[model samples]
Target chain A: MRIVLMGTGNTATVLGRLMKKCGHELLQVYGRTSSSASALASELETNFVSTPGDITDGADIYIIAVSDNAIANLAGELKLGNHLLVHTAGAVSKRVLQKASRNYGVLYPLQSLRKEMDDIPPIPFLVDGNTSEDLTLLYDFAKSISNQVAKADDELRLHYHLAAVLSNNFSNHLYTLAEEYCKAKQADFRLLLPLIQQLCLRMNRYSPSTLQTGPALRGDSATIELHLKLLEHMPGIKNLYTSITKSIQDHYRRTDN
Target chain B: MRIVLMGTGNTATVLGRLMKKCGHELLQVYGRTSSSASALASELETNFVSTPGDITDGADIYIIAVSDNAIANLAGELKLGNHLLVHTAGAVSKRVLQKASRNYGVLYPLQSLRKEMDDIPPIPFLVDGNTSEDLTLLYDFAKSISNQVAKADDELRLHYHLAAVLSNNFSNHLYTLAEEYCKAKQADFRLLLPLIQQLCLRMNRYSPSTLQTGPALRGDSATIELHLKLLEHMPGIKNLYTSITKSIQDHYRRTDN
Candidate 1:
């Protein structure tokens, strides 16, 4: 599998390394910036290309691991009529490469890729394309590296990304928020770590909603009032408290009803 | 240590079983309701006390594992004069026990306890009381069962609880929100599991803020707009999206600046 890497961002750099490790030939690394392309290409022991048209003559796959918005116009700019041009984006459609290449697809690695990561994170790879022929090609390439592979198109991929936020970004924000509360109170944030991890470990066994245990879920207005009164100084937290509790109650009763 | 269990809710059930497993003597199990007392007492292999006044004659400690609002009133109602009394609550103050007994303290297990949980969660028990002497006793008792134990008074305990909500409740809510998004789009929620666990695992190896990698955190408004637009149908989620993005931006700039 002779693959050309485009966009030397976090995902591109990490994926390039993983591909090289997995024995796939990284034909060339391409980036708008020479530094990025050179860094990644050097790491992969391959040639570096700065321009889209400068892509290696023999590459079979052009993985455009660029931003979502850039995919459409970026692919239009790239001349890869014989190569399978794909963007590693969740929101963008594979049709973006329709005019640029004979084939197109997506190879979205469903996790946060880090530039400093020594190795690739264990995450599922999601692949989809314009046609079964295109999809299978991407899937075959993805399966070369990861066993956790799934087929999902633009709509489902977009949906998965949105859900990814709640599960990863948004949930992490809550953790940060919790740390903020600890900081404001002048308490050790480390004290919350065990409980946080415990909550996470429980998700392996139970649905979070079914496992929800708190004053609001119990309909204990007495304790809820006490909690609200205590959090009077923290307006943001208060709103969060009200909304989440209400949602939990709504969901609980909805399920029961 | 011989201990009496008061109340038969989530906290009591978890702690009672944990203490029992640790080879602590169960002096008695007291509950306001006869059925609850009988049930817990039967399970704990201890006598059932019908009333708060009827708590076991002699015990090293009595854990009032009830709701926050009930603590002070229950403390006032109880007739324990010299015996050690502790309430397992976060929002409530240790002073609540001062009215009923001079030797009152807080034995807060810093984990979200649920009855369905068969195993004891590794909670960093936060123990505090009126004096350093009481704290020593409570701390010693706490250390016997939990590896992670800390001394935090009512004020500090309240702060820890808020942090717990942020890390545990709020974080889990974010996951629930993500699950909702996946369901709405007819996508699999299981896809987010590996990513979520990796974020948590990374915390064991790196700073959480340093691990933050998303469109808002990366200053990629293109991806941000795409996510926000996707969340337009969910007004509640829209507000959360706004607040969390603002928080991350503020946090990033503050740290960077």
Candidate 2:
């Protein structure tokens, strides 16, 4: 299948490489800038196009892998004829690509991607389409490159995007905050790595709420007070600590009863 | 070294098993009730004692692995006669055991422990002692059962304990919330597991701040607003989403400059 890859960011580059590696024919690489388009095209052994009018026609599929804000604008600019067109975004609706072609859909990768990463992690693709035929096409294409692929409409994808933010983004922020706190107190942050890894391992087998541990879960007010006192100087972290602790306690109290 | 394990909780049982595996002599298991003490003692192939007066004396170390609230009261009942006494608590100070014996210290395991877990994860022991000799004894004892061992005083251990809560407990809470959200929406929560695992793997190499990616970090207000609307019915989750998104935006905004 001949594919036209759009955008040159992390998601774009990684997905483009994956599709190419899976034996998809890359007809052209498109980017807002000529340099980026040329770089990606060179890497994929394909032609480069920067202008909307210069985008090659009759590709089997055109994947618009730009940022959420840019997807609509880029889709409006593209002319994909009747070829299937898909945008790779979790939050954006597949309808965003409807104007670009008769067959439009989504190919959202539900994992973080970095072009510079040495190894590509497992990417679970959540797909949707304007039609059943196009959806099947996407399902097949996604399955070719990934073992994990599922159908999710815009609403479900948005829900997943929110969950991803909570589990991945917010959790990583907690880690960042913890590392900073460790550094401030002159404690070795690396020592916490094993604990973090163990938590991840436990999550695979048990519900996280069942595995919850710490002063917050134990409702140890003395320890909580000590932690609050320790964080007195750092208002932001302190507020976060207080808010999350309360949330945890409230959750269990409501659930346990 | 002959060891008298106190308490019959998760920490006590797991640590007792670890010590026994490392070839330490388990003299007895002490609990608040005879049945609980006998249960743990049977598991450890040791004797059981419920009354404080019945606790065997002259052990190399008397490990008080009870809850933080009970640590002080329990320590007061113990008669160690200069035998080393230690508590496996992260936030509690080594000084808490000083009243129990002439030689007192702490043997807090930084990792979360559960007696029911089939496979024990790496337990990093944080040792603190009142004297250099007691510290050496603890260092050797800890090194016997675990590869990762370090000396951290009360203040430092407390700091790490707080950080552990943030990274492990708080993060696990986020995961729980996310899983709940996924279940409510009928989206497969398991799909997000790869992303969570990838985040953990990335943490080993990069600082989490550098790895953060989301609508919040990207400052995409449109997507954030959509998520906020989606979470409107769930007040707790909505509040958390708003607070954490604001935090991510604020954190990077402040640091990026």
Candidate 3:
């Protein structure tokens, strides 16, 4: 498939490389920054364009992997033909690309992708298109690169994006909190790595709810009080401890969770 | 090494099974609940005890894998010799076992442990004792099962526990939120499972700080405001989203993260 990839950012770089490696022809790579765009273009052996107008019309699909805010404006400026156009965004809507072309769709990869991600685990692409035929084409293209592909609409995709934020972005911050607490205690951060990994692995065997343990979940208010007292030295961590403890208590109080 | 495993709960069952599999002698499997104790005893082909008084005296190490509040009481109640008394808790200090004997220590496994864990990954065991010799014995016993064992003090172990709460408990709650969001959208939660798994797998390649992404971390108040407005209809979710968003923003603003 001839693909004109958009943007030279994290998602674009990773996706473009994977697509090219999967035997898809890279028509062009577009970005405002020539440093990244040109470098990525050189690597993919494709044209590097800084402007949306510079994108040619020979490509089968236009994958816009730009930031969410810049997406609508960029699509409005692009001179896309009836060629299938897709934006790799979690929050942005597909209708934003309608002005650019009738063959518009979404190819949202529900993962917090990074350039340093070496072995990109099997990504699940949530796809949508203007028509049934276009949807089939997008699905096939996504499946060629990933075994995990699903057809999702605007509302469902937006919902998944929220969930992604909670699981990926918020969860990573939680890990950071753990690192901070460990550092304060003159403890090695690696001590908690095994536990973090095990928590994820346990999902394969049982629901996280069933596996939940600790003072808050166990309803040991005595231990909870002790922990809160211990957190007095760190004001910010103390607040977080109190908030999470309250939330856990509220959950159990209402539903016996 | 002859081991008398007490408490046939999640931790006890896993540890006992692991120790036996590693060619250690399992002298007995005891628990407060008769059904659980009897079941584990039958599985290990060992004696079962409903009380700590039924302890197989003179065992190399007596590990009290009970709740924090119960540890001190249980140790006091147990009519056993000093030998080496160890309580598996991060928050509870080594001093908690003072009633048992002078030969006391802690053998806390730093992982989200449970009996149903399919493949118990190499979990790090944080160990400490009242004396150098006791610490060595505890460390050696921990090392017998897991290669990832470390000598940790109570102060450090408490920090480890705090980190565990953030990484394990807090992260799982985020997952719960994601599941809740999925239900609201009438979308199958399985669609996001692959994405969640990949996020975890990527940890090997990138530190979370380097991979942080979202409206909150990106400093895009525009998208965040939009999300907040949309979430206003859902009071519970809206509050959660607000707190987490504030937490992330505060984190990045301070760390320049």
lDDT of every model, 2 decimals: 0.80, 0.90, 0.80
Ranking by TM-score: 2, 3, 1
List the candidate 1 regions with Cα displacement exceeding 4 Å: A45-47, A69-74, A216-257, B32-47, B51-54, B73-77, B218-229, B246-257
> Worst 10-residue stretch by lDDT in candidate 1 chain B?
B204-213
DockQ-based class of model 2:
medium
Tens-place lDDT per residue, model 2, B46-104, is 99999999987768889999988899999988777799999998888888778779999
Error of 2 at B159 (Å): 0.6
Please give the distance, in angstroms, between residue B253's alpha carbon in candidate 1 and its true position after superposition.
5.9
Fnat for the candidates in order: 0.55, 0.80, 0.62
Candidate 2: misplaced stretches above 4 Å? Answer: A45-47
lDDT of 3 at A182: 71
Residue-by-residue lDDT tens digits, candidate 3, B17-60: 88888998888777888898899989888888887777778578
Looking at candidate 2 chain A, the ten consecutive residues that score lowest on lDDT are: A74-83
Question: Candidates ranked by DockQ, best first?
Answer: 2, 3, 1
lDDT of 2 by residue, A74-178 (tens): 888777779899999998888877778999999999999999888879999999989999999999989999999999999999999999999999999999999
> For every model shown, what is its TM-score relative to the native structure?
0.88, 0.95, 0.94
Candidate that would win on TM-score: 2
RMSD of each: 3.1, 1.9, 2.1
Global Cα lDDT for candidate 1: 0.80
* Candidate 3 residue-wise lDDT, A115-162, digit = tens: 766666668899999899999999999999988898998877888777
